[model samples]
Target: MFTNPEQFANATKTLFELQMNTFNALTSKAVDGVEQVIALNMATAKNSVKGSVDAGMELSQAKDPKAAMDTAASQVQPAVGGAVAYGEQLKVIIEDIHKEFTEAADHHMAEAKNTLSALIYDVTKNVKPGSENAVDVIKAAIDNAFKGYEEVTRATREAVKTVEQEIAKATAQVGALKPAPKNEAAE
Candidate 1:
């Protein structure tokens, strides 16, 4: 709906730049997420190897089979706890990425909508008298499109909230299941 060739070219260039910027931001975010996951995995692997070595030593030093069994049993709870903590960390990373992406997208979408509205308004101002009805119809369509976008955005936000709540609940449950004291186990 641009009036001049220059206007159309400028608009096209602006849209292209916006898309490129968005792509770069998303790619950077993905890379960060990957880095986090790699770091976490490396740390987890290191600790696991150390733990295994230490456990082996402890078992080797045990005077009897029963003592070796006790040593192994003592490591179970901590291993499970570590696993749960790792899962929670992953969840946090993923949620953070999703949030950042959503915020960026929302910002870009709003900017685009405003730009489009302004362009439409400018174009409509130059229309002849008989074309008023067509302009009105176009404006109405644009309004409806915006309304639809808002509704979808709202629903997506609600869904994200629900998923976050569920993850929190599950994490809490796992956290609550700490191992009982050795003395208690004896009883």
Candidate 2:
């Protein structure tokens, strides 16, 4: 449809504008979700440690060590509660983001596919029965589309693997660290 340079430039500009808007909105949502998660985690971690130690000290004054430990255990419940809340909140936020991103990607993918389809159609519409150029162009477009699909898939897999590895490493580090004692949990 964009036969002239001017029309092509305008179309490109419009596409870029739409892409920028989508990108900015996605980034904003992601940043807000991350910030909330970080804040919630920090607060929970702080309170869990502090409550464990303070309760431990208060309970330690009691004559029974087991009862004192039980009391301290009851005091350090923020982590579970916070994690539950964070999980639910983060789930919704992440789902919303995924929906937005998927919708955007689908829109672009469909458009690209359509454009290629139309280009091939146009090229073949008037070609001689054995036109070499038409066959070559169609083959090239198909190959390019397949390459693009594979690249996107590979990148997605790598990103998922990287995130999983980082999560595992963090978990291992936390597990390796010596847990806080009844009196020194926070400190």
Candidate 3:
């Protein structure tokens, strides 16, 4: 029990500040992710332009139809490889951001639960005689709420894991389907 109103107010202010700090950290992470994406895009665009120019020059110098076809075939494997690498990098960035956000949120939730529990315990301790049953009921209710929250969080984590596994399987299949070097060599 907070015997003093000032003490309660101070606790409230501290909680508010903690929330603001968490929010700012999340915002900074989001901005950093965006910057990384933009930088990747810019570099990809520059490389693409350079590749196009170089390929054009090579194609122009081709001695015949076979040479032209060979030049074009050589570009395919590199382009496909670059695309796959880019996708993997982008996925990593997204996962990192999500991981940070989840950790921060979990930390905040735990802090809040502890604070509330402590406050409840203090209040119940200071209560008049014959209020033990009421305190028990309050504690039970809080326990049930925590149990429900834990179940939901577990379910959500399992779903996310399932999705990630599916994505990984699909990516593996796509990689396996890459054009065989033997076929490209035959060209």
TM-score for each predicted model, relative to the true structure: 0.71, 0.49, 0.66
**Winner by TM-score:** 1
Between prediction 1 and prediction 3, the one with superior TM-score is 1
- What 10-residue stretch in candidate 1 is worst by lDDT? 14-23
Candidate 3 pairs with clashing backbones: 1-122, 1-123
- Stretches of candidate 2 exceeding 4 Å from the true structure: 1-71, 126-130, 150-187
Which candidate order results from sorting by TM-score in descending order?
A: 1, 3, 2
Most accurate candidate by lDDT? 1
Q: What RMSD, rounded to one decimal, does every model reach?
A: 3.8, 7.5, 4.3
TM-score comparison, 2 vs 3, better candidate = 3
| Higher-ranked by lDDT: 1 or 2 | 1
Clashes of 2: 0
Pairs with backbone N, CA or C atoms under 3 Å apart (clashes), candidate 2: none
Predictions in order: lDDT: 0.74, 0.57, 0.68
Candidate 2 lDDT at 93 equals: 51
Total clashes, candidate 1? 0
Q: List, residue by residue over 60-80, the lDDT tens digit for candidate 3.
A: 999999999989988888777
lDDT of 2 at 143: 54
